[model samples]
Target: MEDGTKFRNIADLDIADYLDKDQFARVLNNATSIELESGQTLFEQGMPARAFFLLLEGSVKLTRLSPDGNEKVIDLIHPGQTFAEAVIFNGGPGFPVNAVVLSPSHLVSIDAAAYLDVLYDSPKACLDIMARISQRLHWLVNEVDRLTLHNATYRLVSYLLDQTAGASDESCDVCLSAPKHVIASRLSIKPETLSRTLKRLSDSGLVEIQKDHVVLKEIGALKKLIQLETDHFPCTDKKNTLAVEIH
Candidate 1:
């Protein structure tokens, strides 16, 4: 997994979206690979920002620790996504939050200087990165608006509808890729509240909750329930954007 050749073969990286083959190869050639077991720390909050990581395999959770030691889960970085790209250009030289391995994972740590150099050398690549950062900022604004203005049920229902986007079938399966509590934190809902909301949805015949998967029984009805809210607060496929590094 550490080999540059191995990195090249993973289509999920999709480096070609922004960089050409030659540029992509150069970046990987300069990258240093790091592997971690589940629950291991990748970097800590306030650590000097020296590198930006690409998750080659598995999942990583980005979290912020409060002064009193409370943890807020900001995002779950999945494979095929890059995290902390903004750190490369930030005026401050430290990470704003901590990243931990959600499962056994392989990551490529691209030196900040090397990445910056490539961006400087390629206008197209630099613009691509900036556009991604802009999109993420917009998404965060939408997320905050949803959390503050919407109720728990609205938020949870919106989340469930979002999961079924782009599906051909009327029904879709959503796997809770992380623990329930972690997903609750990401949604800014109390764990018990999330449980109650799911139970209500199940009782009403909207969705069926298995151990870790939620099967939408009536997708159209669920979507219609939230249509008005979604009209005002549009929810994009945040995952598809590929540049969010929320801490």
Candidate 2:
């Protein structure tokens, strides 16, 4: 059987969450499974994005090139996440970034033209999908706010807290999804800066590093640290006077 004709379990696809039963079956009928190796290019920056993907295993990084030819890591994708979905609806240029596989990865590529065909059959589904995508857009907007408005330590704290996976205990064990340098890139910080931040965090009793794993000694303290950063921003002061806001 060809790659596109191979039978795949619907349960393995995270993109299925965005559609109803009938729509999922329709889309699945046109899906294809692809396995890629580490250091492989799933799609380049300008390649025609005819489909979106659901990663079942391993990791991928979305990146863009600057005018000076430096690559900036946009986001690191882990398993159970759908990527390139925006391109299907973008209706403009090709994919906005290059999606490179960081490890051996298994993914399901959904044919965008087929997906749109399904949507055309049901007008309500189109609104539902767009609403869901728009809802998810808040995260991207907040990411922009984080990158441009916050300091390096705030971003690192937010990243660490995100890796905790909702551990309610006073302490939590976290494993990094990628190397220090890749992670630094994803966080938009220099590798040396990440190292220094980690050391400072370690010395401050906020966390302890063990090779690729980091143990958050005080998750509460880390949360407070983020809040502290928020509280201390000079532009966001809220006093006993008129309205104050940070742009």
Candidate 3:
């Protein structure tokens, strides 16, 4: 993966842009890449946080098991995104959730100690990392506000709008990063509720579903719906902005 230009093009490795080529090479040298099959556990909660990971391909679910043995899906990480980042610095030296592959996946593991050493050597790189983390924190705060203030229908609609924020065409295809049940868990709703919401939106001519893909037929109407809700709820960054791309 470190074949010169190939590494620089990876969207998840945008951090390379902040460093000189030599510094980027040092960052790459300290990392190891591996492939895993579906149902594999990448890491577990409470384990020593020796490293953080980048999802080069496929998806991974970050989940925490509750006291009653129920699993709460925190997030479904997409390709070109990193997870367990907070553990290396902001949080303690332990993973707060379990990262399990939802499909056959490729990942790059960067040793925390080595990566931190590189960060300390470059002030600009450190500031860039902080900015990225701050973006994520903002998204998380909005996510919490969304969950607490909105109903299932509003949350689902808002999520659909967020996913299609950058699409250029009138209609766009959206595939769930994980399964329906996993997505429902992340949205804090039951699978049945998600199905119902999709059906409701489809009946209203907003979206159409084909197998696992949701073709958004009415992007304008969807945006208007979210806008109407935003007027009532009043979020800071309704457009998703840099927080969405920080993945």
Candidate 4:
């Protein structure tokens, strides 16, 4: 897809609501669109930072490559999410991690300097950018908490339970954002370990994994098995706030 079409697709997403039509058009005009095949590197750690990416289609994996040549997957980003926003202002170092396309993907890359200009020109855009950064930080913290559990089974089950919040109860189906190994890396577990954990969940009658879709047979029991404590994390109430800000 061209950069303009990719920007329009992004504009259709909820996150792009904060941008005005003119600003959005200017951003699209300044961005470069690229097509990446599976396993293509989008950016690497320690390289000069120049742009931030907005995923238009397919998935990208953000990973930190260790000195010993090991890779730790930090995040799996899908459509509508912006990556490397932190690099826009820091100007300290290049991307602290590597981003690679997990499948054939389309992305819109906005020059960091141009983006900063837009932010300075529009107060509302600045606030929206701040909110996005804050939201991403919050998610990273929560992901850390989820991975702190000692058992792989607990982590896998907890992940499934987390997916249920935005899911349809009648369908009880949730799509896996990436392949099993990629998700395993994100959870800091071996692929075999993830497979074993899934088998255990199935054996316990908690869920049924078919292809990339996990069908929840007993969500209540699965919640109980994971010992979920909902009170610890308050749900966000952004209906009116988002409506007013984006519109």
Each model's lDDT: 0.77, 0.80, 0.79, 0.75
TM-score of each: 0.85, 0.86, 0.88, 0.83
Give the residue spans of candidate 3 off by over 4 A: 1-8, 233-247
lDDT of candidate 2 over 1-247, digit per residue (tens): 1333233454555466657787888887788878999999999987888999888788999999999998889999988888888778778679999999988998888899998999888777788788878877988899888877776778887898988786984999888878889888888889887887788788778899999899999998888767766676344444311111211
Model 3, global lDDT: 0.79
Q: How far is each candidate from the true structure, as Cα RMSD in Å? A: 7.1, 5.5, 6.4, 9.2
Pairs of residues clashing in candidate 1: none
Name model 1 segments beyond 4 Å from true.
Answer: 1-14, 230-247
Off by over 4 Å in 4: 1-8, 161-165, 228-247
TM-score of 3: 0.88
Local lDDT at 202 for model 4 = 72
The order by descending lDDT is 2, 3, 1, 4
lDDT, residue 156, candidate 4: 73
Winner by TM-score between candidate 4 and candidate 2: 2
Candidate 2 regions off by >4 Å? 1-14, 233-247
